[model samples]
Target chain A: MAEKLLEIKGLKTWFKTDDGVVRAVDGVDLHIDRGETLGVVGESGCGKTVTARSVLKLIDMPPGRFEAGEILWKGRDLIPVPAQEMDKIRAREIAIIFQEPMTSLNPVYTVGDQIAEVLRQHDKLSRKQAIAGAVEMLRLVNIPNPGKRVHDYPHQFSGGMRQRVMIAMAMSCKPQLLIADEPTTALDVTIQAQILELMQEMKDKLGMSIMLITHAMGVVAETCQRVVVMYAGKVVEEAPVEALFGNPRHPYTQGLIRSIPRVDRAAAQKERLEAIPGSVPSLLNPPVGCRFAARCKFAMDVCVKAMPPLKEVGPGHRVACVL
Target chain B: MSEPLLSVRNLKKHFAVSGGVFAREVDRVHAVDGVSFDIGKGETLGLVGESGCGKSTTGRCILRLIEPSSGEVWFQGADVTRLGPDAMRALRRDMQIIFQDPYASLNPRLTVGAIVGEALQIHGLAKSRKALEERVLELLETVGLQADHMGRFPHEFSGGQRQRIGIARALAVDPKLVICDEPVSALDVSIQAQVINLLEDLQEKFGLTYLFIAHDLSVVEHISTRIAVMYLGRVVEIAGSRDLYDTPLHPYSEALLSAVPIPDPTVKRKRIMLQGDVPNPIRPPSGCHFHTRCPIAKPDCSQRSPELVEKRPGHWVACHYRG
Candidate 1:
């Protein structure tokens, strides 16, 4: 078996609001092998982002707390590590590219300066060397005229270019894993494809693993080797990409795949999209048993009474639902 | 054939930008220039483009939410472009809009019942309080929301549910033409499909026409009978959905189509990365606005703008090199 670059076991993150505790990520388990791309998919507020943030300890801790979890990076448990140690792990072993580049980047600094800050802090490079590295990173992401664009502020660049700059900055340290949270959500479809292609190239060249969080199954089908389906802060299904798309086991996964509009199929012949009825359950009072039971068409009595443990149904395929 | 529901001809909205306090009117953002399209009765026409391409402005101009600098807007055979505020207010019953951001578009202070029934009250659709409550419940049910939830505030609902409420509000006035301005862009993928399906069902039941403006190609292809590709506030290509996707004649359209990722992993798509960022809207490129980034730009592209011409049956493309 390939060595696991990142292993997440029984990860549970919660937000303590005045009203109640919101279990954002409850007993989620996933693993990304070295040099592999894992796609994490779910509807909005499904805890896909919370899972990603937990890997980096990026969640704000005032109201948010990491209740219980073990994120193992290269055999090191990131969850129990001290803050000082976790900082080194964050800068060297794992990096993240956020969804909105306009907000992720600082407005006060030039694009180059922002990127250089990352390199200088992590790699301990001189200011001059860091600037050169920033330009080099920009070129790697295929930003043309990087020499001039380096001095431009974030607002000066278009959405696509800003995304490229974000990617450049994230990859500046050549981390072992890159967690991209809906990196293409804010971009046009054309620009989205370009960014995805660029990420694929970077992965191939750098041999870095990726945890891609997106709501678009089309993106997962295209880019991911492995897929995890989350529903209301829990993983309902996990499988290889082909298996998930070809024979989705969980009802939520099946409904999600059936909902996407495809161009290849005849429009009139296509069935009315089968949406998973009802919205994602509230995390503050998430349902017992399967979180998806409320919306699952095939719900049984067992589904509502007790939480289902993720069971291995086939080789590398796991599902957490009482069928 | 019945008269078209909405006809927009030579619609233009340009914004003058001054360089400084003393600077002359140095540039104009040709946000929407000479864009023309018609929405047939009970048909959905999808207007698609990248950000800053003026798809939203076109929708706004037709609704007169933002007055166009110049154009002809003919609704039900009447010239609505020249209408004053009072006339426009009277005409508002025939046209309504559903904005993209559900949370931002909705007034948070109001309850769901008030938000949905506000239009009915303003238009005097219901006289008694009891009559308004009944109508509001009917509207909520039409969009798949429960009547019991009417007393709840906007923040109480999820993004998907909030959008449904927005849709219900738009339908409250019994409008013949609904301008959906990227209504599903802010939604999760599964929720987007649900909303699109709901929109389609509502149109069929109400015999309504929709001018759907979005940046997503696949979603547009699935929902629209006809699709128009816009570039720099100009319509670059327009055709029936199948023809446009199968054999896009315009260079920009071809590039745009090629960028959409096929959900199937076996199908490898050749991605055409357009060079340079979208030019500043304040000083859009002269002549053919897309020439600067267009893959196949002839010398004539710089000298004169191309007019939309029929290359195939029911397919129009604006390109100097459309052979």
Candidate 2:
């Protein structure tokens, strides 16, 4: 078995909102193997982002808190780790990249300066050395004329280029794990391809695990070795990428995969996409039963009576449905 | 084969980016430049491209929502570009648009019934209050929303529900052509399929034609009978959905299609990585707008422009080297 780099067990990251206690990442259990790419797939409000944020303890306190579970970074629970310790672990051992590049990057500073700042923070390099390191990082991400473009501001680069800059910054410290929250969601298809390829190249070169959180199954299929499907702040299904796509036991997983209109003859011939009806339940006042039961075609009396437990069906394939 | 319901000739829309001492037209962003296409009665034409490719601009231009700087828009034997405000108002009854952002499109202050009914009121389609309320309820039900939702505000509903409300409003005018501008793009993946499938069902039931504008190729492929690939304010290729997917004519189209990651893990596709970011629309590449990033571009590709010429019986391409 591959060595576990990061293990998250029964994580319950909830937010005390004005409405009520929002169970954003309610009882989630997942892990990332060393040098493995794991995809966390779900729609909005499914808690994929919350789960990722919980891993880094990035969720703001008072409003947000980890109610339960352990974020095991190499078997060491990071829950009790001090703020200063987390600051060290963040860019040095584990790093994160958000969906929107523009928001994630500081606009006032140059791309090179921002990257060098990260290096200076974690690696503790001199200003001159860090600047040189920033240029080298830019080159790794395939930015043309990196030396000159290093002086350019975030706004100076296009969306794709900005994303590349973001990637360079993320990879600068050479973290063992990278948490990408829909890294390419804000990009075009061509640019997304470039970014995904660059990510793959970076992972290969640096030998790092990636926890890629995205809603698009095409992206999951293309990059992830194993996949976890989330619904209404809970894990609905988990499996190896091929097994999950080939034999999706969970009704919700099946609905998601079937709904995506593939660019091929076989998919085009299908009369219509099998859209999962109804909407995701509000986390603040979530349903008493299975979160997906309302929209599930395979829901039974028992499914609505109680939330089902995750049960193993096949090798490395687990589903949280009664069926 | 017959008189197209809509025919656009050399449509162009430019926005002046002014700065410096005087707010003169320092530079013009060529948003939609020299684009032409024909949509036969009830035919769905998919317009697809990246962020600055002007697919949305082209859709808006068809309805004269964003006035074209230069173009001829012929619909049912009349020139839409030449029509006065009153004439245009009358014509708008036949042309409706579904906006991308559901949250922004629907009036938060207004009730769902009021929002949907406003169109019928504007066009003076409803005979009485009772009739209008009944019709609004019927429209609500048609898009899979309960009649009880009619009295609620836009904020009360989810993104998918709000989108349905938007759809119901668009259908109120009894439009013959609907410009669906990334209607499902804002919704979640599972919800997106619902909207895409809903659009198709509505198209069939109402005999409505659609100019579906989106950046997602797969979603566009599922709905559009014919697809037009765009790049930097120009349509590089147009073909039947299957033809475009199976054997793309233009180098750009081929690259664009290849870039899409197929969902199935077993099917290993050779993704053609596009070299760089989309060039600035303010000062687009001189000849072939795509020449800057195109892998197969030649010297002549920069010196002269390529006309969109018919390559096959029904297929068209704008490339110097393509057959």
Candidate 3:
């Protein structure tokens, strides 16, 4: 059996807004195998980003709080770790890249300096050695003329190149796991393809596990080995990528798969897209039972009375619906 | 047969790039470089490209939102480019646009009722105060918004609700041709389906024509009868959506279609990724704009430009090779 890389059990993350407590991530559980890619699929405010953030302790603590959960990394609990220890784990074991490279990167600093800083802080390398390491990292990401381009500022690089620099900095410390939150959402299709290909190459070379958070199902189908579907701050379905697309059991998951029109399919044959009615449930006052019951076509009285538990419907495929 | 509803001939929009101490115009960014297309009555034409490919610019030019450097825009057998301000304002009543970001596009201070009814007031569609309020209520209901949402501010609504309000406002003036610029790109997956269905329903009810401009090929393919692929500042190929996706003609179109990540994990695509970034529009590749990054470029590709020509009956391609 493959070694378990990370395991999240019954995680509940909440935020105290002026209106009420926003249950951003409620009772979510997932696991990733060693050297495998796990795709977290959800729309805006579905708690996918918050769930990834909680794994790294990246959520702001003033209003954000972890209610109950266990984030087990190689059988060790990460939720209660001290900040000092967590910092080391963040730099050496897991690194994250964000969607908007322009806002994430500091405009004042040169790309080389930013990358070198990561190496110096994590590995405690000398300044001269760290500079050389930054150049090598840039080259690994396939940036042309890395030596000269390394000194350029963030504004000097284009959107795609800036994202490559972000990838280089994230991989500088040789982390065991990488969390990419909408890493290619803001990129052009061509640039997105290049970045995804580069990440695939780097993953094979380094033998690291990846947690890809995105709303695009196409991306998940192309890159992920396993998939987790979230709706209204809860996990609705989890399965292997092929099984999820081939035979989606959950109603919400089925709706999402049907909604995305395929470029390879003829649209005229279908009268219109199969759309789920209504909108996502509000986090402040989420529905009493199934969060998707308001928009689901297969809702029942039982679904409105109690929240469903994740049960294995097939081998390695789980769904959280009563039906 | 009758003439097409909209015919754009040789449309070009060049933005001047300024530099140095004096900020003098040193060069021009050829945004929409001499593009032409025709859309029949009640047909949806999709303009697709990466960022900076000028798809949005072409949409804006037809509405006269941005003045084109040189072009002939014939709408309903009238030359829109030659119209005076008063005549242009009248033409605008029959043409409307939906922006990408609903949060930024809407007025924060105004109530939903006023936002949607403002267009009716401008065009003097309402006959009386009570009639105007009734019309606003009717428009809200048409867009799937409840009557209670009239007094709510923009911030009080969700992203999907805000977009419905935008659609209602566009429909208030009874426009014949609507330009949807990435309407669902900012929406969640399920919410995107709802909005798309709403657009389709409204179109059927009103017998409307649409110019759908988007980067996602799947969404574009779903809504468009015909698709035009753009690169840099020129259209490389145009054909029926199914034909274009099944067997693309131009090299650039083939690369673009192959880059779309499909939603099925079992299907492996033969991705033909172009090398290098899109060249700067101020000084695009001397002849063929995509030559710098074309995977199968010939020596003559850099010496002469290819004219857009019909290869198959209804398919058009601008390339020296393949087509």
Candidate 4:
């Protein structure tokens, strides 16, 4: 296997509120190989986004705290890195494309200026050089009329176009690892495909790894090689994309896959949709043992008694369930 | 089929946009234009489109939530388009709408019971205070919510729970037709299935017809018996769910279908990457509105507008390149 670009081990993130402590991300472990795409799939409040933010140390710290974790990026421990050093890593080594483009990009700055700012910060390039590089990055993402669009503000662009600009900004510094947190969730399907294709192309051209966090299993199937399924606040399952889709070890994964309506499946006259019975457990005071035990149809007494650790079910396939 | 439940013809909604201090109508946003469709009794029709495509506007227009500039909205042999305010208010009992954002739709100041019971009070369904309380509990239970939750406010519940309350409010009047306007789009993926199943169950139990409007095609396919594809305020294609997905005759439909990523990795789908953003609704491309970004557009596509024609049984498409 190629060298791992990013490795996360025993990561835990928690948010303390007046009501109680919310374990947003609890004990998530994964690795992203160089030039590979790893998908993190989960419903809202499953800690998927939190896990991504934790990797980047983007969480606000007074109420939100990183309990324990080792985030190894290119053999360096990101967790123990100094704040100033981490800032360097964030700008030069790791970049994130947030879910909402409208809020992510500064409205006051032109798209070109935003991208140029990143280049200027990391590479210490001149304004002219940075602007040229920004235009190049825009063109690299397949944005048409890049020269003209670079001068346009975020609002001047459409939702899809703004997303493209975000991607361009994220890639301006040419980071080794890109964290795309639900980048296409807000986009329409047609435009989503375009954005996904652009990301895939950028991955190939830039030789950058990606940690894509999204709820859409279809996006995982299309772009990712490895998959991690999260429920409530823990990693329920992790496997190769093909293996996970073909034989979902976790019941939650099975329900998610079955819920997605496919054209081929519709043609086969499948009337019974495999919907999970109950809603996701509340993050504040999530159930002990299995977080999904409340909703899991196959859950047993062991599932309720004690939390199941991710046990290796097969080679490279791990599931955290007591079935 | 026993006089379709609802029929819409040549529906058009135009919003005036002011330019400057002159306050002149610089442009009219053609939110919905020349759209027509019919829903069979007790059958769900999914209106699938991207943002700014007018699917939601069409739903709002049918309910007279927003007045249409020109169109005919006929419901059960009555021309509802010409109905006066009092007549429309009376007709509202038969037509209800479940908004997209559960958080925004429900009033924060009101409790769940009052929110659900308000509809009943409006239509005079409940005679007294006791009857209203009983009816509110019944509505909550019908939508899979607890009777005790009636006392809680919208913020007290999760996204799925709030949506259930929204559904309860919509069903309070015993509506014949419900317009579910992207009701599940704002929900978590796992919770989405639960809500969808709830909607399907309610539809069956109440013999209700749904005009389901959403940008997500997969969700629409799961619930809708028939599907209509809209683009730039026009109905590009309409057909049975199976037929539309199996063999989409319209180029736009084909592109939209191709854009949906299949969850199965074994099945390789050719993603049709539509270039450019959705054309400005205010100045949509002349003739065929989709010609600007359509992958299979011909020269005549710009000069001649194509009318929706039935190419096969129960399948209608509007395109110049059908041959």
**DockQ, every prediction:** 0.61, 0.81, 0.76, 0.68
Superposition-based RMSD of candidate 1 using all C-alpha atoms, in angstroms: 1.8
Give the TM-scores of the predictions, in the order they appear. 0.96, 0.98, 0.98, 0.97
- Which lDDT tens digits does candidate 1 get at residues A1-323? 89998999999999999989999998899999999999999988889999999999898997888888798888888877889988877777799999999999999999999999989878778999999999999999999898888999999988999999999998988888999999998888778988998999999999999999998888888999999999888888999998998888998899888887777666542357676666777888888777888888888898899989998988899998776
Candidate 3 structure quality by residue, lDDT tens digits, B1-323: 12488999999999999998999999999999999999878888899999999999999999989999999999988988899999998888899999999999999999999999998898899999899999999999999999999999999998888999999999999999999999998998778888989998988999899999999988888888889999888999989888888889898888888888999999997899888788888888877898888888899999999999999888999999876
CAPRI classification of candidate 2: high
Candidate 3: lDDT of B246? Answer: 84
For model 2, what is the alpha-carbon lDDT of residue B174? 90
Q: Pick the candidate with the highest TM-score.
A: 2
What TM-score does chain B alone reach in each candidate, compared with the true chain B?
Answer: 0.97, 0.98, 0.98, 0.98
Docking class of 3: medium
What is the C-alpha local distance difference test score of each model?
A: 0.88, 0.91, 0.91, 0.89
Lowest summed lDDT across 10 adjacent residues in model 4 chain A is found at: A263-272
Give the better candidate number (3 or 4) by lDDT: 3
What is the clash count of model 1?
2
Instruction: Report the TM-score for the A-chain of model 2.
Output: 0.98
What clash pairs does model 2 have? Answer: none
Model 4 misplacement above 4 A: A267-270
- Flag regions of model 1 displaced more than 4 Å: A267-270, B22-24
